[model samples]
Target: MTIIRQRLNELRRRAFAGRTGEIELFRSMLGAGGVLFLHGPGGIGKSALLDVLADVAGTASADPIRIDGRDVPPVPGSLQARSGSGRTVLLLDTYELLAPIDDWVREEFLPALPADAVVVIAARRPPSSRWLADPAWRELVRVVALRNLAPHDGRAYLAG
Candidate 1:
């Protein structure tokens, strides 16, 4: 088990390059409350950054619940029940695929989450205008548009 864990950690370290700032931001936001959206074009490392955020949440003893939009059911029954009373980090990947539930999630589901629950959404585009237009959501939502790795980081990633 220890060896397996070590290998997993090593793999994670390699897979998540040039994402320290984003990971730190996610960690800081977990305690502040609200939603964080990391959006960029395909292959811009959004998924990798989400993976790092999950690991950071685990290390902080927070519950990291990952939802892949492609596989999740539309209604997402009992999702709130799983949140419990602890700090829960909800990571939503491929968010564009869940457009059918977008309104529900933004208007109803997210509002119902526990106070300590923080959501991190990764999509190909920025969040809907509604999130920014509403005074309440505007204050709560933070958007980070990811970009390609710096040349130095790219070199380090390749060398690893």
Candidate 2:
């Protein structure tokens, strides 16, 4: 168990590099009853950032439910049922694959969630214009464009 724990810690450290601010911002936004949409190009570390956010949610005693678009059915209702009542953090990865249900999620599923439930989406593209165009959603949503790690952080990650 100790060896497994150590290995997991090492893997976590290696998976995330120089994303403390992002993680903290996600946490703060969630605490304030907000949703986060993280987007970036391929291999830009969006998935890794989601992993870190999950860890942060766990530490905060919030239930983190991770939904990968590749594995889930391409339906909005399917995701709606996944979010049970509680202080839950919904982590949606590969969100671009679920483009068909994007409007449903933004308009129906998210609004139906409990006030404390937070949704975190990581995608390869920015959010649809509908989210930005709507004056109401614009206030509740936070969009972050992830970037590559710094040189020092990259070196530290590789050295580890």
Best prediction by lDDT: 2
Q: How many pairs of residues in model 2 come into backbone collision?
A: 0
Once fitted onto the true fold, the runs of candidate 1 whose alpha carbons sit more than 4 angstroms away are 3-6, 76-85
Candidate 2 local distance difference test against the native: 0.85
How well is each residue in 102-156 modelled by candidate 1, as lDDT tens digits? 8888888898887767899999999988888899888888899998889988888
Summarize candidate 2's per-residue lDDT along 67-125 as a digit string, tens digits. 99988887976797677567879999999999998988888889988776788999999
- What is the Cα-based TM-score of model 2? 0.91
Model 1 residue 37 lDDT? 92
On a 0 to 100 scale, what is the lDDT of residue 134 in model 1? 93
List the global CA lDDT of all models: 0.81, 0.85
Estimated TM-score for each candidate = 0.89, 0.91
